[model samples]
Target: MNRRYVVHVDIDAFFASVEVLLDPSLKGKPVIVGGLPHERGVASTCSYEARKYGVRSGMPLRKCFQLCPRGTFVRGNYRVYEAFSEKFFRVLHSYTPDVEEASLDEAYLDLTRCRPLYPSFTAAARDMKCRVEKEMGITVSVGAAPNKIMAKLATRMAKPAGFFEVPAGGEENFLRGLDISDLPGIGPKAQVVLRMLNVQRIGDLWGLPRPTLRSLFGMGGEEIYLQSRGIDARPIVTRSKPKSVSRETTFLQDLWDERLLLAHLAYLCDRLTLALREDHLYAHVIEVKARYSDFRTEIKRRLVVMPLQEMGKIYKIAEELFRELFASSRLALRLVGVKAAELVKSRPLALFEPYSERQERLGQALDRVRGKYGFGSILTVRERMLDSVYDFEPRRGFILKTASLTK
Candidate 1:
């Protein structure tokens, strides 16, 4: 059996760093990437300079401005971010085939089998970091340890372009002094519960009896116990396919008109299907969700016989589900969402399908045109209504804070 080692690589302030790389004038300034201060979104990421003023990822742009008034705000560009993420992953793939992309800027590589090829694990990690900096103009912090949990924790300790490694059997010593919150799966809510028990450090939690901890936290306590002992058995999964793709929007004001809802659903379906086509995958399930002004929410799903990648088919199902769900008690809605699930790794291969061969070819043609131009270049009448409801500047590609972990 292989010696089970994982290497975690994290780009430092990825979104902000890319912005700086594009415009060197913003290098040393407090750069915040998400949207303008008055916009209805949060910071996707911010520079270390912005961190000095207590700004952080997911902080509301308004609040970030309140904290760092002098910071440069950018409406984030996902195309550029995705390009950088590709470069980041390529660097990791050069070292090991078993690399798991934790997020757009974080990855875990199982270098256990390839360790013998390098002089030492640290040397391999340093080479990865230097190559990333030199080739991509981005710095990465790397951590090497026995398993994924310790590797991730080590990366946290070695942030801002640093490297650290823990030999096999030294996981406990490396993690014992760290905060309980630093452990994976330990969130703010878990921290409060642990603090009530005076378990502040990972070392402190390791001293508690498993049953007592289990009584307090149920299954999560068992997980904490194992993690405190640096026991993580999960393997690195390479190029893992996403189980589902979804798009959602929260309204600035509650909306009650069905036409407006349909328009929004149309745009959501278009975006979701575009993503599906991009991944070269199809969805066997379609789902729609809506939240009313009074806080009532409902989600409806439909199972399909054949996987689908066409926008019309997806939108039709989502719209029908939405109508069926809200037909009776349609109130002012604050949010709406569309999702594609039960994904498979290929286009529908059946002899005959819901769409004709010509229709499929047209869909592919439209996708190619949109890819060259922009999402707004080709849109249905209903999707065009999105412009009136919510300024749909397709080139601007708005993204919210989807990453919770630090890079």
Candidate 2:
């Protein structure tokens, strides 16, 4: 009876670390990668050095400036980050074909089937960490355990550049003393509810009766109960494709201006279409969403007769949806989002007969240039409207890390 083993690998301060690796002069210093500290954005990643000053990812750039005034801030380059991410995943694939990417900077590899290839799972994990650091010039932490829950938790425990493992039978002992908040599913709201019940630790949750937990949290309580006891039966899915790809931004201040909203929508559509083309996917459905200053939200969607991948087509639909959805209230909005769904791997040429092949060719050409230079190297006039408000280079999504930029 061989035990299953899952390995979770996370790049240390990925965006920030990449910055330091590119420029050794920035190494050992506080690096912030999202944007300038005063910009209307948040930290994407920060070096461990900056963490000492309470600077963290998702913290407002203004607040991060007040916390770590001396920190070096840089607008991150996503293409460079994407390159590094590809290298990182390539290394994982060398060890196991059953690797699951959790994000651009983290992944889970099922080592149960590969145990015979390596002397031990611990050795395999250590070798991976070493190779990543040696080859990529960036450090990573790895966690190995019987399940994904414990594996990810193990990775978190081994931060900076370290490795940790929990033997098959030691799961309960390993999880017992940890805080309830340490579990992946425990959000702030869950924590508030648990704290009210005097449940401060994972061990505490383990001792509660199932009915009591269910009565308090419904189906979520059952999940809390299972996870608290280190019971995750989910398998490593190596081939799961994303259901959708979307991007959204929250304004530093709410705005009623229509032009600015359209500009932002166009930019977001460009980003979404770029990603769709990169993955060789197309969307049959497009959605536009907006959140008002009062927190009221609205969404409008359209189903296209043919799946679309061109940015111009996607943006045009998004613009229509936005106008139609907001035509009545046109409330001042604090946030706006665009999403492409009902994705398909490929579309037939006949389906695109009504659309412009020239535009599609143009999109492919633009992607090639951007792939070589970087995202937003050539911006559309609509996207350029963001220039007045954004000082950092534009990309598909929000900026959240602070690092030194190259070129």
Candidate 3:
């Protein structure tokens, strides 16, 4: 059997790096993205300089501010970062067709088949890394190993524009002495148990049999057993189509106003439909969720005869679902959400008069505009009310999250 060669590539501080590219003056400074320090939101990303001060992504904006008072906080433009992500993926595709995108800033590439095209895996990985930086103006850290687990671990070892490799026979040596947390799925709770078991490092677990580990951790035990031995049989493949897509948010306060809730629902539906069209799929089922101020949750779902792709059609069904949930309860609402499910790749074409061709054309045009300008570029009148309620960016729309800040 041919030994598998997997390489993991990750952009260093993706959001902060993109911000520096946008404003060269911000380079070398501690730049934080998400919202301003005084704002009530989590830090999306921060530069290494900010990291040194203990400012990390997902940390509260207030805490981040306390850590790096000199840092520049930005209400980041995701549309801009998304644009760069396209270029980043394009670079990977040029190297190999077998690529798995883990996120906007990270991917795994299978280079075993492409070995004949270059002198070695290392050379191809180097060329791919250089091309990504050259095309996107951002540095990426990479790691290569005989399998995916070791490759991911190696990449963790190589950060902020660095590369490391674990040769075919060296996986065991590479994983030795690493912290137990370095292993995937090892959490604080698991650490307590592992510590009691006297397995402090990856190498320490080498003594335990697979059956023993399985009994200790259930179904995931096999994964832990194999990963600790530097073996990961997972293949690098393109992502499968999602079973469903959803977008929702918790209100800043319990809302009793139906108009305000519907307005926010329209915004969420727009975002959800944008995602549906991006994947070239349509939903046969539409679902809406509402969480009342009393913490009771209600949901309503409808299956349409004709699957939906256009925002107008999807929003229509979603509106009905929301109304159903709203009318069923008299309590104030704390959260609202929309979900699209039972997806199919082929969007149903509107061939009859009831579904006008003009409406189809208009939906296409609107999607094109949003694709180029961003989701916030075109908002319904109802969605416009969100402009005054939340911090609005012309093309990026409102920053939706669990907590909201009064505009």
- Highest lDDT, which number? 2
Which portions of model 3 miss their true places by more than 4 Å?
239-407
lDDT of 1 by residue, 1-407 (tens): 55677889999999999999999999899999999999977898999999999999979899999999999999989998999999888877999888888789999988778866876877887888899889899788888888877888888888889998888889878877888888754646679998998989989997889888768865456567777888766556555657689998887678888887898788788888888878877886689999989876778886553567888878877887888777856588888999997677766644323346776687889889877777677889986665554443456432223421110
Give the range of the ten consecutive residues with the poorest summed lDDT in model 2: 398-407
Which tens-of-lDDT digit does each residue in 1-407 have in candidate 3? 89988999999999999999999999999999999988986888898888999889989899999988889999999999999998899889988888888789999999888878767888888888888988898889999998767888889888979989889999888888998889864645568899999899999988989789868864346547766777655556466656689998877789988888888888888888778767877776688999998887878886443467777767776777788788878889988999987677754543311355676677778888877887678789989887656666656568644344422
User: What local distance difference test score does each model get?
Assistant: 0.80, 0.81, 0.81
Backbone clash count for every predicted candidate, in the order shown: 0, 12, 0
Q: What lDDT is obtained when candidate 2 is compared to the true structure?
A: 0.81
Tell me which residue pairs clash in candidate 1. Answer: none
How far does residue 66 in candidate 2 sit from its true spot (Å)?
0.9
The C-alpha stretches of model 2 lying farther than 4 A from their native spots are 240-407
lDDT of 2 by residue, 1-407 (tens): 76888999999999999999898999899999899977987899999999999999988899999999999999999999999999999999999988887689999999888867988788888898899889998889989998888988898889869899988989999988899989865656679999998989888887789888768865356557777878765555565656678988787778788987898898788888888988988876689999888786778776443567888778877887788767766589888999987577766345224456787789899988877767768888887776666644444332323432111
lDDT of 1 at 350: 46
In model 1, which regions exceed 4 Å deviation? 240-407
